[model samples]
Target: MPHSHQNRIQAPQLAAVVVACIALFTDMLVYGILIPLLPLMPAVSRSGPAATGLLFAAYAGMMIIVTPLAGRFVDRRGPRGPLLAALLGLGMACLLFAVGGPYWLLLVSRLLQGAAAGLGWVASLALIAAAIPLPKRGTYLGIAMSMVSLGTLAGPPLAGWLAREYGHAAPFVFATVVLLIDGALRIAFVRPVPPQADDPATALDVLRVKGAWPVVILIAVGSGVTSMIEPILPVQLHEALGLDSVQIGLLFGLLVIVAATLNPLVGAALGRCSPRFLVFCGVLLAMAGLLLLGGGARHAPVIAGVVILGAAIAFLVAPASTLIGVVGARTSPPALGGAYSLYNLAYAAGLV
Candidate 1:
C-alpha cells in the first residue's frame, strides 16, 4: 500500500477525482463516437476511407509513440497542466471534425487529441493514487472507472440519436460542449494539492523493478488480444448468432459495467491481502475469459466469456494501478505518473 503524508480523503482530491472521471469519460466517449464515423467521413467528403483511416491510424499511432514523453512531463509538472491540455486538445479535435477539414488538418487534430489524452489519462490516475489512501484506493478507482462505462453507455446511442435528429455534426458539437465544460471544471478546481517527493527517472527505470517488466508484458499482450475483441465482438455475435444489434450492445456494454462494478471489491481485497497474488490471478482470469470467448459455443457461452473477462479486467486493472501507485510512493512520488504512462504505452503497443 502506498502511504502518503495525507490521511483519509481530502475534499479537493475527491473533487479532482470526480472531475477526472468526467474528463476520462468525455475523452473516451468522443473516441468511441468518432470511431464509428471515421470511415464515413470520407464518404461525406472528397476524401475516402483510406484517408480517414490514415487519420485514425495517425491518432492511435502517435499516441503510442508520444506516451512516454507525456508521462515524464506529467511526472515533472503534476496533473494540472496535462489535464487542461487534454481538454483543450479534445475540444479542438471536435471542432476540426465539425468543420470537416482537409485530410492533413484532420490528421493533425487526431495526433494532438491522442497525445493530449495520453497525458491527461496518465496524470489523472497519478493524482487519484496520490490523493486516495491505499486501503480505499481500489474502491475509489472503481468508482472513477465506472464513469468510463457511463460515457460509453451514453456515447454510441447519443451520437446515433443526434445524427438522426440534428444531422451528422450534432454529435461533434455535443461532445465539444461536454469537453469544454469538463475542461473548465478541471482547470477551475483540479490543481494538484502539493508536490511530493516522487522519484524522477526515465522510462528505463520501469525495467529495474524485479517483477515489474513481466507485468508490463502481460498487460501489453492482454491489451492487444482484448483490443481486437472489444470493438468487433458485438457485430460478430450479431452475425453469428442472429442476435439483435441492441442485444449485442447490451452484452458488450455489460462487460464494462461489470468490470466497473467489481473493481472496488477486488481492490479492497488486494488492500486487505496480497496484491501480487491478486494480480496474477486476475491475469489468469483474463486468459480464461479469452479461452471462453474463443470457444464460440453458443450465445450463452459468449456472454459468459464477456462477463468473466469483465471481472478479470476489474480484478487486474484496479489492483495493478494501485500497485503501481504503491511502487511509486515507495520509490518516488513523481514516478506514479511515469509508471502509469508506461503501463498505458504497453497496452497501446499491444494494440498496435
Candidate 2:
C-alpha cells in the first residue's frame, strides 16, 4: 500500500517535470530556429549587419523589461497562467515570422518572442521547483537544461535544412506545429500548484538574500560573454574559414551538443559540490576558452575552444540555477518565481 501510494505521488511530479521540459525546449527551439534564417530576412539582407544586430537586440531588450514583471506575476498568481500565456505569445510570434513582411513585423515578432521566453523560463523553472523535491531538483533541472541545449543544437541545422529544401516559411511552419502540440500537452497535463504560505518576496526582497548577488553577477557575466559569440562567430567563420551556412550551423550545433552532454553530470555534481566553487571553475574555463578562441584562426583550435566553452557554460548554468532554486526555497518559498525572474533578467541584460 505504501509503495502504491508513493507511486501515485511520483506520477504527478514526473508529469510536471516532463511538461516543464517540453515548454522550455519549445521556447529555445524557436529561438534557435531563427538564428540561421535571420540573415536571410529581406530587411536584414538589404540593411546589412547593423539591422541584424538590431533584431537580436530587440528580443533581448524586451526580455529584460518584461522578465521581472512576469516573475512578480508568477509569484502572485501561479505558473500555469503565465506559462499558457507565454505559449500563446510564442504561437503568435511564430505565425508572424511565417507570414514574413515589413521590417517592423520582424521586430514585432522578435519582441513578442522575447516576452514569451522571459515568462516561459521563469514559470517553467518555478513549476519544476514546486513539483520536484529539493534534494532531486538539481537532477531534474539538469535534465530540463539539457533539453534547452538540445533544442539549440537541433534548431539551427534543422531550420537551415528545411529552409534550403522547402522555403523560408518551412521552419516557422514546423515551429507552429510544435508549439500547438506543446500547448495541448500543457493544457492536458499541467495543473495549478500553489505557492507556499509564506509572504511573497518582492524583487528587492528576493535580491536581499545572502549570496544572491554573486550568483546574479556570475549569471550576467557568463551570459554576456557567451552571447557575444553567436553574433561574432558566424561572421568570423565565414571570413576566416570560408565556411558556408550549413557548416556554420554544424559548428554552432557542436558547441551546444557538448554542453548538452555535460550538463547532467554538472547537475549531479550540484548535490555533492559547492555551487560557488563550481561557478568559479566554470568562469576560469570560459576565460581559458576565450583565450584559446583568440588564437583559433585554425580549425582545430577553434573546435577545442568551443568545446571548452560549452563545458564551461554547462557548469555555470545548471549549478547557478540549482543554487537559486535552493536559496529561494529556503529564504522565502513563495518567492521562487521572482528569484528565477531576476536570474533570467540578468541573463537578458548580459545579451544587451
lDDT winner among the candidates?
Answer: 2
Count of backbone collisions in candidate 2: 0
Error of 1 at 176 (Å): 1.0
TM-score of each: 0.72, 0.84
In candidate 2, what are the lDDT values of residues 1-352, reduced to their tens digit? 8655543438888998899999999998998888767766676666767777778888899888777787778777878998999999999999999877677888899899999998898789878877865546556866777787778888888887888788889999999999989999899988988764443564566688898887777678767767767656766666687766666677778778877777778979988898878888898989988887777788888888988998898888767666766556656544664566677777888777
Weakest 10 consecutive residues of candidate 1 by summed lDDT: 328-337
Residue range 1-352, candidate 1, lDDT tens digits = 3455455677877897888788878877887665444444544335643454466556667778767666666667777887888878888888888776666777777888787767767767666766665556556665665676677666655665676578778889999888878878987888764444444554456546566776677567555544556434544564578754345546656777777788778868985878668777777888888888877758787988889988887766767656655554444323554565566676666655
Q: List the candidate 1 regions with Cα displacement exceeding 4 Å.
A: 1-13, 35-57, 75-78, 98-109, 126-146, 164-166, 190-194, 198-203, 230-251, 265-305, 315-319, 329-335
Q: How many residue pairs clash in each candidate?
A: 4, 0
lDDT of each: 0.67, 0.79
